[model samples]
Target: MSHYHYSADQLSQKQAYKFLTGAIAPRPIAWISTHNLETRVTNLAPFSFFTILSSRIPLVMLSVNRRPDGTPKDTARNLLAAQETKNETARTAGVIHIVTPELLSAMNQTAASLSFTDSELELLPDELQLLQEKDAPLAVENAKIRFNVRPFQHQLLTDRSDLPMTDIFYLEVTDFYFDETVFDAKREYILTEKLAPVARLAGNDYSHLGLLETLRRPD
Candidate 1:
């Protein structure tokens, strides 16, 4: 086996992006759900650009990209709306339900870039069941865990002065819903074996988190 290294200054932006994305291949998918205030449409999409931002503050982050014309994507726009809900009365309704193999097809459909007026739910309405209280659509039968995000801040990248920019959303998780079968009393946490979460790989590929084994760190 061989290893290659590039100094920070030596790496071009394009090279850096490719190296990082490829090196970090097979990242977990964050299947986010959001609602459009104008159309009242609920959208769900799988984002490899998602992760838990914090545990102390119960925060989550979703990275989003702007269109070539500088318009925000649906997920970004909906997140902005969710943030507004937070500032108004300090509570948010929409939640993000994670996608597993069971919901792969529906997840793909949601990822389709549709017209702003077009309803994504129209593609897989039967597959997705909305949990009414949250007013957010989820692949209830397929999802193993659902996390409700109460937004604290919607921050733009300071370096995003360039056109077709990138943005980061910092959200505080308010609720956690999970399938009983996925939890283990012995472990005091959900079993990855039962959950079978899907993760994104390079170029139209995905992998699963299989048979985990824990190791204690050397102190």
Candidate 2:
């Protein structure tokens, strides 16, 4: 057997990032939508650095990296502002949508580099429908599954001088909306084949569901 190793500390930031992203296979993409309180414009973006943090509390975490200029990304900034809102009734909220094969093109369009004040939803194809949740931000109509989330906690991963590098958001799911086509009523589970979810790979690569297998847990 043979293995290769590289020390993260000794490697450049780009090198370490490439290694980590390449090593992490098939990361779930979080298609998040946030409404800018000050701008009153909606923002949408995809982040693969996301996962469920606590199933018991219905919490999910999103790791948002700062831009090259060390400025907070629009999504992170909006979420943090939402967290600090004092008015319960007017507090900001967001929506997390599932990315499927059908929505891949639209999702990629939203990833385009745009000003913080610009709304990405405007770039999406005209065929794509955008819907707004009761009090939450806008959501994709074609998404198979969508979660209405509210910011629960926000933490900045910073250096010694307190220069922020990444923002970690813990959001609590308040509501779930699933398309009937991908849901199994009797089994109470999502039909993976029907969902046809897309996942992120290293660089500009993405993956489909590919092979499916069922592994039973050992008693």
Clash list (residue pairs), candidate 1? none
lDDT of each: 0.73, 0.89
Report the error of model 2 at residue 168, Å: 0.3
Total backbone collisions for each predicted model: 0, 0
lDDT of 2 by residue, 37-145 (tens): 7999899999999999998989999999998778899998888888887446753388999999989989999999899879999898888898965777988888999
Q: Give model 1's TM-score versus the native structure.
A: 0.84
TM-scores, one per candidate: 0.84, 0.95
By summed lDDT, the worst window of 10 consecutive residues in model 1 runs over 133-142
Q: C-alpha displacement of 187 in model 1, angstroms?
A: 5.3
Top candidate on lDDT is 2
lDDT of 1 by residue, 1-219 (tens): 897767977887678777777779778777777778888776766778778778989988878867767778887888887666556553454467777778888878778988877766677757556555544444344567888776677776544365657778887787787888898767779877878888877766778777678899999
